[model samples]
Target: MDARLNYFGNQLGAKFLKYINSAGHALGLSSLPAATQELVKIRASQINGCGFCTDMHTKDAAHAGETQLRLNLVAAWREATVFTEAERAALELTEQGTRIADAAGGVSDAAWAAAAEHYDEEQLTALVSLIALINTYNRINVIVRQPAGDYVPGQYA
Candidate 1:
């Protein structure tokens, strides 16, 4: 399928993407675990139906040594036995955060408590920021109908 517009080539969109990508870089430096970061990114992309992002993040995850079993099970994390408790909490938080528009209330207290149990304040801060950043990328890519399956790991690095 063709995209509605060429977001990369457009001057305005390119400028916006550059800045947003910078925000992601800042979050990448946060205290959150890198494995959790990729899982959150990939999960959020799937929820948002942002194929381009899913492709990018999954490859990035694999390149960083993420096992295929865990990657394949992210979408079914509630039933999957692959993730740790900490990772599960973060994934739950990512789901509620990404689907905010579909629910009246935001993330559940139980979910927050679960996350708190696993992550320190600094890590929590990074997780929140990463969630927000991935959602932003998802929206942009979905709106522009960015094509998927051509991403190379660390292409943006």
Candidate 2:
């Protein structure tokens, strides 16, 4: 299927993406574990039903040496035993953050505290920013009906 627009080819869209890409690049330099970052992106993409992002992040994570089993189980992370406590905490926070409108009060203290237990202030900052960023990416892709399943790992890198 064709996308409604070639977002990457459009000049305005390209400029907008450049700034967000810079934000993502800065996040990459943070103390947050790279594995955790990918997992968070995958989970948030899954929650948002952004097939493009789900495809992109899962492939990127796999190319970066993420296990197939773990990547497959990201959506079921709550019941999966493969994840570390910290990873699970981040996933929990991702869910709450992405579904803020679903739950009243917008990200419960429990979720925040759980994430805090696993991450330092700096890492938490990166995590929070990553969640917001991924959600933004998800919305754009879903709105544009970006086609999925053809992304090459590091294609945007």
Candidate 3:
């Protein structure tokens, strides 16, 4: 299937993506754990139903040596026993953050406190940034009806 628009071919879309990719690069250098970052991305993408992102992140995680068991369990993280407490907190925050509109009060204080307990201030900053950033990507890809399953690991890097 073809995308509605060739985002990379369009000059304006390319320019916008350049900045978005720059922001993503900065977040990658933050103190947040790499594994946790990928997990958060995968989970948020799943929740957003962005097949392009879900395909990309899951493939990226696998190529980075993440176990299939954990990757598959991300969607059902609440019932899974494969994740650490810190990861669980991060996942919880990702869910609440991604579904912000669904919950009238936004991210709950309890979720915030739980995540704060596990992550440092800098890590928290990165987490919030990552969540917001992934959501943006999800929206773009979904709107454009981007096709999935052809992403190669480190293709953008």
Candidate 4:
């Protein structure tokens, strides 16, 4: 299916994307674990129902050697046993952060404390930024009706 607009091709969209992508690149260099980063991206994309992002991050994770079992279980991470405690905490934070409107109080202190137990200040900063960044990307893709399943790993790199 065709997208409503070629967001990456239009001049204004390209400029906006350049800035957004730079933030992603900075997050990539952060102290946050790479696996946790991918998992957070995948989970948030799933919550947002952005098929384009789900496809992109899952593919990117796989290309980086993420296990198929783990990738397949990301949506059901709460019930899954393959993730580390740190990863679980990050996922919980991602869910709360992504669904902020659903919870009147926003991300709970419990979620933040759990994440704090697993991550350093810098890592937590990256995780928070990553969540916000992925959500922004998700909204853009969903609004533009971006199609899924054709993304190659690192295509935007």
Candidate 5:
């Protein structure tokens, strides 16, 4: 299926993406763990139903040595035993953050406190930024009806 528009082909869209991608790269250099970052991206993408992002992040995570089992279980993370406490906290935060409209109060204090217990201030900052960034990307992709399953790991890098 063809996208409604080539977001990369338009000058304005390309400029927007350039800055967005730059911010993502800087966040990647933060104290947040790479594995955790990818997991967060995958979970948020799943929640948003952004197939393009789900494909991209899962492929990227696998290329970085994330096990297929863990990748497959991200959507079922709440019941999975393979994740660490820190990862679980992050996933919970991601869910709350992604589904903010569903919950009138937004991300709960409990989720924030749980994540705080696992991450430092800088890591938390990165996590928040990553969540926002991925959400933006997800919206853009979903609106454009971008196709999935052809992404190669590190294709954007």
Candidate 6:
């Protein structure tokens, strides 16, 4: 399957993609743990049904040595025992963040407080930024009907 438009081939999209990529780069330098970032991205992508992102993030996580059990359990993270408390906090935030429209209050105070319990201000900033970034990517991919299952690790980098 082909993208409706090749983002790189279109001058406007190419320019837009530079800013898009910058967001990813910004998170790369953040203190948010790499493993957490991957799980967040994968979970949000799953929630958003963004095939492009789900495939990319899952592959990236695997290449980074993330365990298959952990990756597979992300969708059911609330019931999984494989995650740390911090990872659980991050996952909870990711779910609420991705499903913002599903709740009237946005992310619940409990979720926010829970994330704060695990992450310092700096890591919190990164986690929030990462959630926002992956959501943006998910929306873009879903909107464009981008096909999945072909991403290679580091292809975007």
Reference-based TM-score of each model: 0.96, 0.99, 0.98, 0.99, 0.99, 0.96
- As for TM-score, the candidate ahead, 3 or 6, is 3
Q: Write the per-residue lDDT of candidate 1 for residues 1-157, one digit (tens) a residue.
A: 8889998888998899889888888888888899999999999999999999999999999999999999999999999999999999999999999998777788888989999999999999989989999998899899989999998987778
Candidate 2 lDDT at 106 equals: 96
CA shift at 75, candidate 4, in angstroms? Answer: 0.6
Cα distance off (Å), candidate 1, residue 20 = 1.0
lDDT of 5: 0.97
Q: Cα RMSDs of all predictions?
A: 1.0, 0.6, 0.6, 0.6, 0.6, 1.1
Error of 6 at 10 (Å): 1.1
Q: Show the colliding residue pairs in model 1.
A: none
C-alpha local distance difference test of each model: 0.92, 0.97, 0.96, 0.97, 0.97, 0.92
In Å, residue 155's CA in model 3 sits off its true spot by 1.0
Q: Which residue segments of model 1 deviate by more than 4 Å?
A: none
lDDT of 2 by residue, 1-157 (tens): 8999999788999999999999999999999999999999999999999999999999999999999999999999989999999999999999999999999999999999999999999999999999999999999999999999999987899
- Model 2 scores a C-alpha lDDT of 0.97
Provide the lDDT at 8 for model 4.
88
